[model samples]
Target: MSIPVITLGAVASAFVPGLEQLRGPVTVVRRCEELAELVAACQTGLARAAIIAPGAADLTASLVDRLRFTGVVIIALRDHPPGAADPVVDGIDYVEASVEPAVLAAAVSRAVGRFEAESARPRDSHAYADPLGLPDVMVPQPPDATEEPGTGRIVAVWGPSGAPGRTTVALNMAAELAAAGSSVLLVDADTYGASVGASLGLLDESAGLAQACRIADQGRFDGAALGRIAVSVAVKGGRLRVLTGITRPDGWPELRPAALGKVLEAGRSLAEVTVIDRGFCLEADEELSFDTLAPRRNGAALRCLEAADTVLAIGAADTIGVPRLVKALAELDDAVPTATPRVVFNKVRAAAVGRAPETQLREAWERFGPSVRISAFLPMDHAAADRALLAGTALLETAPASPLRLAIAALADVPAAGDTRRRRPGQRPRNVKFPGIPARLPR
Candidate 1:
């Protein structure tokens, strides 16, 4: 079968000479003003490929977004000058770097062939927004959870060393928010000891964030590509879109800082709340020693802090734990000066454990006052936590009534769910980046 081809509202002078060699049915428009009409006509499903001039002033990002929705291949003129007015975004399949007639035709043929193969297969909801303009496929946003157009929310969960329950807190918090009918995305941003997949019993097979970094290095990442990379977790009573961590610490280099920022931003667009499970250490160096995974430039965890609107500081409830948290709190101040850390003492057992844990924490904070906001307290329930972990489920699902789970759920303040555009004092703008060059390039 032959493929359908299209000309923009006006044919470029550069492409006119070789128009006859283009082997497809063509529809041409008179001028740039009619480009919309051409695009609209293409939506009737005839155009499989679009041939526009590099100098075509009518092309636009929105137009490309629309054509992309229709699953059409965009073939720009090969002779496009280096600084053409209309630059191609990353999603474009092939670019004819030269204006040769045969080369352009070959590129178009390849692009159309790939598009047809994709169209022949089942639809991929994650790769594209549904035809009817429905919410995103993998992580649909709740109708009431709308942001102020382009703004997004960020949530960060941090814990001191010694199994202070960061993942547990982040997972349950995200699940609770999702259950309340808000679209939530849970991200495991911990560079070291990223056990989100293991805690939930997900197979640690693919490197999701690595793939995203590769895409972002090419400057092509968007909401649609994000949905494709994020792994969807099916919670019993809740829905969560998760972007799991790298399988091994060595894989951290693949998770570029800029790409990670963009991925979080994209998650914010698709989800009402983005819950991040961060590494305990906020320092941006790989030399620090850790238990689970080796470091990759060591900036992954700290990057989460810089991006988060609210930072949840978690710590153990025992004697040594309190002092460690106090010290950790001091480090947090230096790392994220713009945001104050909120403290949560996990594994608190007032009955079986000593009553003095809270008192000690309060006293220590009095001397170290104003730096940390000691907020919630979670009691210890070792039996329930162990059972839930063994069953490959969260405490909320395995032991909903457990004191620890209840405490974590209560930490969900109204502001976290109500406000979607809040930002910390020091977070970088959405388009800016920290000091460093990107490490990976797109394949």
Candidate 2:
């Protein structure tokens, strides 16, 4: 039996791509506003399916919810998706140019065949819904209940190999921003190992990334749920919302690229400044053949980098560290072709490198021709950092006078309290400022 044909009511120019893959009868309609006309057309009883672009201006939660008429299967087309390009929605089948048209035709044929499958096997709701008996399908509500351009600053702190203190810098940077009275969210996207919880002295027994993936999987992550999962740590006068990493490496696969991207996107929506704690850019070997226990997709961190407005690359100040930083710069160049990372030299205590660590890094990076700007230089102060970690406190609270803390503070002070400035293309950055060292930022 031939699969009944569907008419496509797409926002202008969007229907061409799917037509290549969809062999069924396709009627290219105009804008989202014409959905009503399309529905009226369906009343003629010729079309059994509708191909609608979710990006269409007329498409809305209300609109989709109303599309429950019998014998009509509504398929929403999105150009790109939550992770990769597999566009099959929970209820709708996706037809695209790349895949065999037969695959989609078969899917639609299955739906038509299954009109009686629900009644034939009348399973309880529990069979379809999750174990908790919640609704099986929970599509994400648009942020603010309306679609608008996002407004937030996301600074991703990434470094090269050899533990160049990416976490430390991220922690203090978030703290300093919060101290200056900016609402900040610190995300631990380090899929290899997440130390943000430990670094901040947070017990964080609750699900962080794992739960986030679950929520995102349902596509129902909202602003309120985002707040509930974020572990709060006291910064200067403000608070730091920390999203810790996955507890075990085995769960890494669950952190799908799209889900992680959604979490970050949602986080940015709620924060004045979002600081990300990323894993080593050089360590892509999260995938180990022998270790089924540890599947290193590294998807979470990479997604963060790709979505980042600014990336802060950390490098150790020592000879070995400098060379590694040089190479790490190369890797980031390839991995994130779209992003321009701000390079910072951490633990620059040795006078042997030069009096000015920033100048040295600038010189080295310039030779590579990537044009990296040295943003900040944090001196090495192991004693203070160790003491803070042991006490489960931040260096700002544990050792206010430490040179390392001061450097981080100075670097962090560049952005004004609640500055909300969007980064422009090809903008040059200057040193971050600190009015003066205080007893501490108000808690």
Candidate 3:
């Protein structure tokens, strides 16, 4: 098969003669001078491989990612020794500037072979069907896809952009799991804005999450090291370990994917249940920090959703919240497409959704997202929130019997016969009745 190729910059002149000799074998279909042209050429399927000078105008990581995503293999001309391509600027095979034309031809052939190998991988395995049997679900693909038959489940709590009370839900879930005698580990993983520690009045001085990431980065992370980083927080009848998030957003780069993955696997090994409280943002740009393999702020959230056995997707319950929730689910369809997330409504009130908000919400969700089922409903309790915030702890510690805590605890015991409402063939579950709010959220 003829491998169609493209070239940019003066490097093309050096390879054109050799490429001429192999014209029938390797076709130089396009000679692009501008980076934009290169992007367009790759995007429009004009070429399958590219040889670019490092000095090509506007050559960026984003462009490389787009090319790679679209099945175009890039070969960057580098000054490095020619054993293998440099991993720094992703999707590019490098050859020394002064390499022989034959050597350059061999490099192009090697890049094509490598590209074919990668292209042949089972990427479609990550695509799952939505509840309605719609084909566009993008679930996070695990590295070692061989899932064990029965392991203690990991539930990642994620919400939309707004403050939909994800930390509140995650804290109480971990606490509930602990009280049930399941060893639980509560992780605060918000890179943009972390409040799990603040919610519990935990200290902000020591960086537990960052420290764990550092140890994990060095390949020395373990359960014992996990204990060293995490702080023991007292709950109703037991204590659970909590790994606080980074002190600031600037520290997000430290939460590298390799490091974070190790921590997650280790958490499951230690705890019967691990509840990771994540941030709202879930953008997955494979080219993020492509040069150094640095972490993006949203990487942790994306990884959490993918790694977890289940996802607890929390959203606001008001009018704005409901519509936002619908849009968020649609976006999630593109992000973690294959994940069947259990949606929870937080801050449900009469002012925003009118009387019998649950009924209105149920119909709206059924209309907008036939496949997304409302799993749990938590009421807005300003007093309970205030008291817990003021006391520097979870609702279970201060307002255990409050409606809010009760609703959250119910969610924590999912699939336990009476705790959850499963969707039947033609209707909502029979035994479950969602708790409602007596008052609305005060201004």
Taking every candidate in turn, the Cα RMSD to the unseen true structure, in Å, is 15.6, 15.6, 14.0
Cα lDDT of model 2 by residue, 391-442, tens digit: 5656666676666776777667543332233447634223322232222221
- TM-score rank, highest first? 3, 1, 2
Pairs that collide, model 3 = 137-337, 137-338, 138-336, 138-337, 138-338, 139-337, 139-338
By lDDT, highest first, what's the ranking?
3, 1, 2
Pairs that collide in candidate 1 are: none
TM for candidate 3 is 0.60
lDDT minimum window of 10 residues, candidate 2: 122-131
Alpha-carbon RMSD, candidate 2: 15.6
Candidate 3 structure quality by residue, lDDT tens digits, 118-234: 543322222122322322222332222123332445788887878998888898888877776777789888888888777766544455777677557544556655655566666
lDDT of model 2 at position 98: 34
Q: What is residue 187's positional error in candidate 2, in angstroms? A: 0.6
The per-residue C-alpha lDDT of model 2 at residue 376 equals 65
- Candidate 1: residue 263 Cα off by (Å): 0.7
> What are the lDDT scores of the predictions, listed in order?
0.62, 0.61, 0.69
lDDT of model 2, residue 323: 79
Better of 2 and 3 by TM-score: 3
